[model samples]
Target: MQKLFSLTLFLFTFSLSQAQNKFGNPEVDPVQIQKTYEQWSVYQNKNIMLSRDFTALDVSSKEITKEVFLDQLANGSFIPIRLKSDASVYYYKLFKIQPKTDTSIKATINQIGFDAYKNYKMEGTVFPKFSFKDLDGNLVTNESMKGKIIVIKCWYIHCTPCIKEFPQVNKLVEEYKDRKDIIFISLAEDSPEELKTFLARKPLSYAVIPDMKEYMNEALQLNSFPTHFILNKKGLISKVLPNFESLEVALAKESKF
Candidate 1:
């Protein structure tokens, strides 16, 4: 939800400006834009009002209603906005809208630019050594993962994009269920109780580790959610991906080696 609010700020900045419309030359209603901006500003950093709190049009001059926007975001039908931040303010860049006709604007949930990570040059580097217990009290350690392909996912319960990819991730787990050399793990920032409740509702196939915010932030130096890391048999990171499809491709290539 914090990620959603950050994205809302980015979108608001764009909508409130008088800059030319990036999607064609659609004439946007300035009066309505100002009204929507003021309404949203009241809730800035206070609440999540992304769905239907205020009425605003997309770059295509189409009304961005609640249902249509939420559906598109959930179905992975919208382009994700990439974000970067400094000590004071957050910055974001809009990706090239696909089909050149889609007007809906959406931001990546809990996603930060690669440069945001302390270990940005992740590939070919040895993953940090650590030991942690999963929900079932199974001790997982760096040494234990040696001589195998390890797939790790970093996410939390409230991340929309993270939840949206659960089915795809589960399929990957099922696909490799019989493989002895591959292991899938997920590091979540939520507490054990929150994770237990959420997992009961929507199960993830990965070995779930709870209360890993310190490990994720201090050890992993990650500022993004829904990030992935694939390590080879030597415990060296072979791939770092932002989406499931790319992780699948990387896994396919690594499994052969």
Candidate 2:
């Protein structure tokens, strides 16, 4: 978890799954090290919160072992994220534990929601609001996405999976372009010059919006490319579709306005 801030890291952070290190212990080692992500999977789908105060106290005087994410107690049992290494470490836990299920179905939703959290509404409270520029360089707010069911595909050209998924995404866009009840947008992390020239001749006929790096960074806590979210007519985030097939399913499932 390379945080937006902080450059120093610790190596032994993941071994302490059940221990708390609130204050500081000078005896602990201090050297730059990458945080371990092994323990993250255990708490992935469980609603958990990160506590900076608790982490500061633990690693204050010693070398930090891993990067962690913090959340309000009310945020949710678990949150979606990439392997975190930068945010301040926060002690976390699942609000409600779920029973173990078979591996086949587990893999399906883990792709949908982190740690197989699809059955539960993540956040129970917050929804995503995007602010990006339209082709004309006008700033677009989350409210601009209302009225129509909006599908914003976060992507990059180099992404293998994304390249494979483009045609299907384009097809969905073409099918719904005339409906007026829905809209499709393809967003990429690359600069307009880089993406525009490449996609100009492609079948993607929807209005391609560009320059939302800051929005994507915050909403997904990810600088990595090719992430997308689907917004329902009520302006609530209905789905986070990270791939082609999933994106199609979300579009097909939209409740007609």
Candidate 3:
């Protein structure tokens, strides 16, 4: 059995007006969301008002309702948005809707949900050119990144696994800086000065781009933290690795193309 309830939309800023939409969270962006939605009057609305898609990356094949899960995203910070269903689930069984093209948020959800709801390996065509400021605060370019296998780890100072990977990633950068074949990056949303004392002592050999979360996130299709997108010699996104090392080895191997 499934239930469809009204959705309470929330938006989180990810970039300047120019930043890319990496999270696939189109509704979360005020610039691209509805200031108002038709609120539900009762759990049982004998009349359907509108239809929208709900999405999440699932390991569990259970069917939770829309109202049930939206409340969780609002109150239970411990749980990310989840769908208790799978690809086999019917669309109308989830909610009633007009054509997906009816609205902006609707369109974004459809575009993003198509990927978020499935088990996907990151191997596809994407923006190839990449650039960001290195630790010194000087503007860095993709040209400087030539001849290297770039591992752009889209992260922030607060991400745990990001900090955890620093030592090993630094080691890889140290070993390969001269080779022109490999690179490691820890891009953050904070100012370089905020990390100056930290980076001064560590002195990363590869690169560090601070306050670039929005542009880079969009530039790289970033959704998961410590989202590792590997770029090969051709400067294309050759792989998409998520979370910690526990989930990255195969991705690391595959994206090294």
TM-score of each model, paired residue for residue: 0.56, 0.51, 0.46
* Residue-level lDDT for 155 in candidate 3: 73
Q: After superposition, how far is residue 59 of candidate 2 from its true place, in Å?
A: 39
Model 1 C-alpha RMSD to native: 16.0
Best by lDDT: 1
What candidate 3 gets wrong by more than 4 Å, as runs, is 1-122, 175-178, 200-205, 244-257
Question: What digit string (tens of lDDT, one per residue) describes model 3 on residues 1-257?
Answer: 12222221112232322232222222222222233332221211222111223332211323466444333323332123212234433222122223322354344344333333221333445434556667766765678876666677677766777777777666665545565466666677678787676667655444678887677556555666676666676666565555435224533454345
Where is model 3 poorest over a 10-residue stretch in terms of lDDT? 41-50
| lDDT, each prediction | 0.65, 0.49, 0.47
Can you tell me which runs of candidate 1 are displaced by over 4 Å?
1-120
Error of 2 at 244 (Å): 1.8
Q: Which stretches in model 2 have alpha-carbon errors above 4 Å?
A: 1-127, 201-203, 223-225
RMSD of each: 16.0, 16.4, 16.5
Error of 3 at 195 (Å): 1.6
lDDT digits (tens) for residues 100-126 of candidate 2: 423333343234333213212332223
Q: What does candidate 1's lDDT look like per residue over 1-257, in tens digits?
A: 99999999999888856342432231222223223434323332232223112333333434554334434434443322212223232222222234432132223321222221223356679898979999999999999988999999999999998999999999999999999999999999999999999999999999999999898899887766688888899999887776676678678878899
Q: Considering TM-score, where higher is better, how would the candidates rank from best to worst?
A: 1, 2, 3
Better of 1 and 3 by TM-score: 1
lDDT of 3 at 11: 21
